[model samples]
Target: MPTQPSLTLAQDLCARLCHDLVGPLGTMAGALDLLDDDAEAAALAREAAASLRARLQVWRAACGAGTGPMTAPEMAALLEGVLGGGRVTADVTALPPGETFAPDVAQLLLVAALLGGEALPRGGVVRLAPAEGGVAVLPAGRVLAWPAALADALAGQEVEGPRQVLAPVLVRLAQAAGWAVSLSAEALTLRPM
Candidate 1:
């Protein structure tokens, strides 16, 4: 039987979702798979669920989803949420006491910061510093691998398949928000003014 367009789209979405969720979920799954039996797996699964839950809750808070206002404490939780293991550590020496970006800004900034974090594989410091208007992404160290197509997206180009993921989206985001960007071979900093 010929596949319906809706089925095709659904299949495509499923593939994308699996591909995206696979990494973290797989890590959790792998941690469980190493266990002896269902009982062990169940326990490990609970831990994994806790991790995912914490990450999701902080992400939701950072993105300002269903939240009327985001505060400094909430942002701190989000910071700690994204940092797992000794991979990264955030030092919020001074966070704005009672200020938060709009929902769209909050979500986009969170997404951009998360994307920046992914660029550092061996894992270094990624700072969300206060810039002129928006913020600056300070990802230190080498092994930085931002998707190349990101530049094109910044120049207002549509990206093709198997690409257009994080960095590109960040470029597009910076553009949309009137955020000015300064990029080196190793870093990308943006400020909206």
Candidate 2:
């Protein structure tokens, strides 16, 4: 089993979340100041608000308290809200339409999506699909480079820092649920143990 996160790691993650929120919050603040004078600013404010909400929702599922069962559409919406506007696009169409994932599995899928996105720095599709043993997170792009730290973490090695936190958390989550996680240049696969 993977070790639990330490208090320091928790603090670092908090800092990371704050850092992620600051940009959208700053945009909203600036837009608010110009809202009275410019119609464009109102549009900007609305966009910023949506972005902020999406980030919060995604983070809640990724790092916050356990969410109950989630359907494929629900997860896809959350992924689209945060990752769609950027270079990466999320594809959950491979997931069954009527099926719901248990809370832990849902969380795993979200984190796996995030991790897959990280590897596609150049832009690509992050796809979630049912695998023979479990689920597969397949990220395809012109170029793919998996972070060494994350790979180490998946291998059950001790890694530090907020950026590297997700990999270990994923390992722990899968372990707790009796699943095995493996990563490759092609995909991240989680299988029943």
Candidate 3:
């Protein structure tokens, strides 16, 4: 196969990452301002706080933004964040036992799921299945392309496209962890091997 141009690829990816992060952060910022200024909106404030906190935590986890390995809280917080948006619902009974993931892995998986969730604008099902080696995220019957970066990362390659900037970091994380990534847009699936 012909090699892709590196500079163009990198720039495209950066633009995508910036694009994804910008929207969520902006929404979170607005929610924070609402909480800061309102006394009567305590319930709404609480929900906003929970949702924003969860989303940001996932963002940090996927980026592995800390000094060392991530703990359970970080992984859980990221999962919670992905779930907090109230857009996608998880059917999690299919997970395996003692299926703990390193922070970076957990972060990648969680964010990938969030990406799948994004495809389901009308809110269908986002189920996480835990296998012996990793989890599988399936976004079924959704009306989106289900971010190609996720599938590429699972296949042990860097992500391609300006709309998928997070692929490199995610690919790096998967490589460092000695993991294999696979995704299918047939229904938006993520499986770790």
- Return whichever of 1 and 2 wins on lDDT: 2
On lDDT, the leading prediction is 2
Native-to-model Cα distance after best TM-score fit, residue 5 in candidate 2, in Å: 4.6
Instruction: Output the better candidate (1/3) by lDDT.
Output: 3
Query: Compared with the true structure, what per-residue lDDT tens digits does model 3 show for residues 86-167?
Result: 6566665576434555655666666556666765666666667755446666766445556666666556665667656555
Provide the overall lDDT of each model, using Cα atoms, as 2-decimal numbers: 0.57, 0.81, 0.58
Compared with the true structure, the alpha-carbon lDDT of candidate 1 equals 0.57
Q: Where is model 3 more than 4 Å wrong at Cα? A: 1-40, 66-77, 81-85, 131-133, 141-144, 149-163, 187-193
* lDDT (Cα, tens digit) per residue for candidate 1, span 1-193: 9775435434543453445445667767876786665566767677667766656664455322435445545554576646523365454334466777655555556656665666666677666666655566666646776656566656666544333354444554565666676666655666664
Candidate that beats the other on lDDT, 2 or 3, i.e. the better one: 2
Task: Kindly report which residue stretches of model 2 are placed more than 4 angstroms away from their true locations once superposed.
Answer: 1-5
Position 145, candidate 3: lDDT:
53
TM-score of each: 0.66, 0.91, 0.62
Ranking by lDDT: 2, 3, 1
